[model samples]
Every structure is written in C-alpha cells, then in structure tokens.
Target: MAFVPAPGYDPAYDPPVPYITAIPGGLRPGMLFYIRGTLAKGYTRFRVDYATGQYEGSDIALHFNPRFDGRDRVIFNTFQNGAWGEEEKKKDTPFSSSRPFELVVQITQANYQITVDGKPYHEYSHHIPMDRVTWLNVKGDIVLQAASIIGCGVGSAGSKGGAVGIPGGLPPMVGPVCNRPAIPFTANIPGGMIPKRTLVVAGHISSGAKSFIINLKKYSSNDIPLHINSRMIKNVLIRNTFLNGVWGEEEKDIQNNPLQKGQFFDLSIRSGDQNFKVYVNGHCLFRFDNRIKNVQEIDTVEIQGDAELAYVFF
Candidate 1:
C-alpha cells in the first residue's frame, strides 16, 4: 500500500551507522520499512533481524543475512527457543562490497515482500507472529545510511516511528482538532510522488457516511491528475482527472466494493509510469492512466468529507 512514515518517527536525514531505534509500535500488515546502506570494504556479511528482545536468544522472528560466504547467497531463517531454524538460502544477491543499495520491505499478514533497488526480489513467510516482534537490529559489515518505518495498514500497531500517541489511539474526530481546524487535512508530499514512494490515507467510514473525496492536484493550479471519490450511496468509486478546470470522463468499472460503512480502510495510491494505481483494503481497485503527463507536478492532496482520517502520508 502507498504509505508515509508515521509522524515524528520519520528520520529527517541519513541516520548514524549501527543504529538502534524502537519499532514505535510493532509490526503489522500495511507497514513498510527500508534500509539504505553500502557494504563495507572486505564485507563478508550483514544481518537484519526482527526480534522480541535485544538480548541474545530472545526469540528472533526473522534473521536476514546477506553473505559473501564464498558461494554468494542470501539466507533467511528463524531463531526460536535459543536455537536457529534451518536456513532458506537463495543465490539472488542484491548487495555488493562497499556499494550502496536500498531495500524496501512491506509487511503483510502472511509474508514480507522485499524489493531491492525497486525490483521484486524475494518473499519471506512469517515464522513468528509479526506483531510480537518489536526491535529492528541491523549489524555486520555495512555502512547504514537511512532507515524508516511507516504505519498504514489494517490493524497494524506498527512502530509509531514518531512522537506521542499511537496511530489509531485517539477518538475518531469528525470535524476539527480541538475546535477550529478540520479533520479533512492536507500535507506535503515529499519529493512530489516519486516512483516507489507511496501515498497512504487511512480512515474509518463514518456510520452515516454518504461519500468522500480525495483529490491530488497542484496547489497553484486546478489540474487534478487524480480525483478519487467514493460514493457509498451508489456503492462505486469514481475516478477522474481535471485539466484546465474541465473534468474528464469518469472511471468506475472496478466492480469490487472498495469500502464499507463504519469500517476502517487503508487506501494506497502508487505512482507508475503510465498510471496511478489505487488500492482499498490492500486490494487493487482502480488504475487511472496518467492524464497529467508530468506526475511530479502533483504536489497537493486534499481529503474531506464523511470519513474520519487517521492520517495521510506521502
């Protein structure tokens, strides 16, 4: 799903090497993490583990080791009851000595979808309950650049990676914060929707909700490259684009019920070269062709209506 790191917990710049930070909440589906780093000279191996405790023998759920071990392979296994599980190794390696790389891992209910340098690489099924795994430990011969955790999924109590209250802890606000502000808010889409960067909107459908609108456009102009409106009354999700203040044709062939009243939904909009893909509840619901040619100009997002949004991160 398209997602932004939870507020406050997102790193502003490249973090220091050999870093340790609490997974703000814990692992859950729809959450994402990435490690940007370079292998050190004479690098033999590096390991990234998701564990219950920092101490040794603390029930590690996933032990990811990329090694040069002469044969050049990547091994994945579990450590339980103070013992290591049988290793599952694949020859496909995404790292090189003293070279920089980015690894993005997306957590789902059953598996972790890992991609290296924007390419599909591998999948690791969960050996332990993902939510029970807390700390993220990265060690071995590598230089860490940046790492982040984002919370935007169904029932994910992911590391808040930020300051203060949990993602869905607060009462769902219908209107404004404190008093004057509105719940339908807009925030900066950092780097302006770069490919591989996701846009996540999380919210609960209001009990008596009729509809809601999520628009992606430029602040300085009315050219909306993407306009997603969910009409619960009609049970359809409307997709459109506006050019020069003129609305284009509508798209609603997706027969799936994209939402349910009084329920929570995670909406992800992924940027592709030719289309803007939308997912509801982790299911692909719409794919709108790139009507706005230049996707980078889509800088502003606005959401307001019958749904109470938990957060929107891009």
Candidate 2:
C-alpha cells in the first residue's frame, strides 16, 4: 500500500512515507509493514488499526512498542510476576541505544519480525490472524522519519463513524476544574485584616508566625470562571518571603527590599506558565510556577513590617 504523509506535517523535516492506497489487497507470505522514526523524552509510540471498524479482534489495531532494555530500543512483551520475563523476550539479541532504525512485519501466518538499524533484531509470535490486523499505528513521542506498509490492505480504516465512546481517559489529581473557575482566599493579618488585591509567596511558607491565611473557597463549583476559580474557594495560605503591598492591573517591577522576620515574600506570576518570582534583600530569592490556577479573592496580606506594592502584569 502507498503511505501518504499526514497533512500539516512538515514532510522534509519529518520522515517520508509512501501513500497507503498504492499497495494491493493481497500479498505473498512474509510481507512486512516497516516504520522508521526518532525517539525523545515525551510521548514515544504510535498505533494504526482497522479493528475500529469491521475488524474481528479487540479495538486495538497495529502498535509500536518501545523496548526497555538498557539500550534505548522500544517493544511490548509479556511480563511475569513483578519483573521482566526473560523467557518472554522475542530473541536473545541485545537492545541498542544508539539512534535506532527499526522495522516491523505484518505476517499472514505465525510470528513477525522487528529489525532495528537494518539488523534482524526480534520476532513476535501471536495467535491472531494477520487478516484481522487491518489497523496500524506509530506510538510514543518518537518523530516518525519514514514508513512503508510492504504488504496489502494498509489504507486508513475508513472512518470512526460507528465506534463506541470510551470513558475514564484522565488520571487522578485535584486538577483545575473548568466548570468551577473562581478560587477565593482570605488572610488573617495580626492587625485588622486589610483587603489586599494580591497575595504572593516564594517557597514553602511555614504555618503561623504571620503567615498569609489563603483559603480556597467554592473551588468545587461548576459556575465559576475556569481561568480563575470555578468554586467559592477561600483562605488558602500562600507562603512566601516577600509580598508586595500594591494592587491594580499595571505591571511594576519590585525593587529588591529586605523582608522582616515575620513578613512573607510577594511573588509576581506572569500570564501563561511563567515562573513565580520574589525579590528579597536586593536579590531574587526563588522563582517557580504557583501551579494553582483560577484565583479571584485576596482577603488580606499580613506583614510584620510595611509591604512593598506593585501592579500585576496578568
């Protein structure tokens, strides 16, 4: 089959492949569909499958597995108990870490072959019929260089018109909920609480000793602004070493000012995923992402001494 390069992808920078429509429907035994690519630190594999449509196997189609050997090769194999099943390895061939050039076979009968950097590296034996293997994929964060489906029936699996919906795609975490967009926090300053427009922190602020009492209120609600806070959150303490005492929409640079023993620092967070930075004693003490999003209310900013103020950029 001919392999067409995906649209919106830079073909020259990306590995090139023939369009999938040129290949014939049937082929002699021992044909292979080979893909070449580069791997990095992020997502690293791809899978193409016809099983989503009229195929007879599970929804999974074709897939690329990264080998976990000390070398950087990728693969998928059976695991026994809690460790790598030595006997389950496809071959005794040692894995390679040098930039790998690999190959895969889509056979009409028994196991298939996988070669890396042009060498016959591994073999896979499966019970599934090759006719049932219509889908294909190149998984992971590997940059696909080129691919060729040497056998037949290697075109796109029609469309996803009738596939059933799959759920539970997200993992666990108190991720920012889009529906509940607003989060409010209140600080109990030693003096009468003054409504400060912003609250900032440098690092882990110790509890008590003139700490900013930040509360996340109504954060669990769906009606709040997703960019701010979606719920009625309040009084969530944001500990810092230098906290500026100013508010408004203009961005102002904070002159490095000494922080008192009980005064927390003020951190300025820029829009997007910019780092939160604080200035203390004429020097930048710390900078990091607040990691929390959707903030609205700043009930108070308690300080042992006077707080330096500045406008917010975003």
Candidate 3:
C-alpha cells in the first residue's frame, strides 16, 4: 500500500506536524505510546529512525511506513522487506484532512492494540515481543507536531520496564518499519565469491542494500530460494549459497572493499519483528530483542575480509 498525498496539505499553514517520536535504543516490552498528528496536505511517507545524529547506521532499529487516502482512511502497512503486507485502521480512518486525528497503541507481552481518536480499532498478536523498538520516523513530507509515550503498569504503580528476559527501564518500543528514506551502501562489498573473502548470505542478502539484495530473498534453496528474515519460521534451514558475480563466476576478492563516497548502508528486513540481531567481525553489535520477529535462512555465504556472520543463523 503506497500513498501520494492529499491534494494540498501544508505543514506550515496547518498546525505544526505532530512528531512521530520515540527514544532510540531503549525500547522494552509491554508499553503504550501516543502518536498524534495532523494529516496536513503534501504528506507522503512516514518513517522512524533510531540512530541519533546519524540518519543511516547498522545500529538503527525499526521503521513504520504508512499511506493515507487523502479522504477518510490512513493505512499502516507492516514489514520492511518481508511479507505480511499492509494493515488498515478499522474504526476511524484519518485519511481526510478535514479534521485532526490521533492514534494510540498499547504493546503488551502478547499483542498490540490500537485506538484512533479514543476508539479501539485493531489488535495484532505476535509470538515475539514488540518492546524492543527504540526510534520512530514518519516520512513522505508529512509533518507531525506533538507526541507522548505511556508505560505499561503491570509490575509496579507505573513500571515501564520491559519483559523478563530483557533488561529494565528501556524506552518504549514504537519503532517504525516502513517508509524509510533510502541510503546507499558505503562499503564496496565484493560481489560474487572473491579471493581472500569469506562468503556469508546475510552480509549481502539481509541488509536491504540494493535491488539485487532484495531479489536474493526470492531465490530458492532447492536450487532456488523464497524468503528470509527472523520471525516464527521453524524447521527449515538455509546454508552455503554462492554469490553470482557480474561474470557469473563465484566472486573473489581483489581490491580493498571501498564504497562510493557519501554512500551509507542500512540494515532492515520486511518482517515487523525488530529482532534481526546483527554482528560484525564476530562481535555482537545490535540485537533487536523486540517483538518484530521474522527470520530468514541464507545459504552460500561470501565475504571480502575478516568477518564472521554466525548471528545470521537466528
């Protein structure tokens, strides 16, 4: 589900765009947050970012992409690079710019409940937890003016700590998973199997770095692939797939890996789960222990230098 914009929604003329805001790197499980804003004209994409001061980083987490009809409905689609497609608000669609609208959502250990303008709309359940999100963004020129967060009060008078397995007192998880502005890959990861490079399916295929990487998920394991990302998938496994180079040869390393200057890479998946845990050079870097669980299995791994992709195993 994609959206253009209302015919002429203006941010400056309308009330200041309410901020779709959240704390970065501190999302815990079981919390509620309020995201209120005006659907002023000219708003197209809505995204959430977690890495402060830096737009694109491997450390960033969660992004939500939504579309509006510019009439009477606003839709919040699910997943970044995986399936589950789009889900629309049931009660009060806020696609029209005629009046102001607000959306409030509660995240529990088991599911998510949404309320638009004080009325309940929909609830989604997940096996993984949603409490792991830290940053949020809204894109497509839409302006959000104000925002607030509410904590789940299960263990204390107003305790906002995440669930049992994770640490305590982390920020509420409202990270967005779609509508993110595209950032380019900064490192020249050797394509295909190159010499002196270890091959791994995740370093190339899991990062959403390019159109080719996106298409890699569709390649099948039975000499062809289908899907990847960490979610509720069990039983099936993917291993040792080879990178096909520009010459169709298993790629080999030659030059020092260098990306186009001013280019940066982003790590995100189509699944709503925030737990696409990543590591660099055998060191654990980012772990999205939140609820957005959609895992992928990769085969035929490849790499350029000293790096280990054991975490991609899920």
Model 1, 36-110: lDDT tens digits are: 678987788988888887666788888888989789899999999888999888897978764567677778898
> Arrange candidates by TM-score, highest first: which order?
1, 3, 2
For each candidate in turn, the TM-score is: 0.52, 0.32, 0.34
- Regions more than 4 Å wrong, model 3: 1-30, 44-66, 69-74, 80-92, 152-314
- Better candidate number, 1 or 3, judged by TM-score: 1
In lDDT terms, how accurate is model 1?
0.69
| Model 3 lDDT per residue over 1-314, tens place | 21111111001112233233334233445444545455556765454332222333323333334454444344444443234444644334444466545555655566566666656776655422344444444445455543434332223211122322222222121222111112221122223112111211222123322222212221233221211222112212121122232212222222322121212222222221333332222223333232211223322321222211111110
lDDT of model 2, residue 143: 55
Error of 1 at 199 (Å): 8.3
**TM match of model 1 to true structure:** 0.52
| Cα lDDT, model 2, residue 246 | 25
Leading candidate by TM-score: 1
Candidate closest to the true structure, highest lDDT:
1
Instruction: Give Cα distance to truth, residue 85, candidate 2, Å.
Output: 12
Would you list the C-alpha lDDT of every candidate in the order shown? 0.69, 0.31, 0.32
By lDDT, the candidates rank as 1, 3, 2
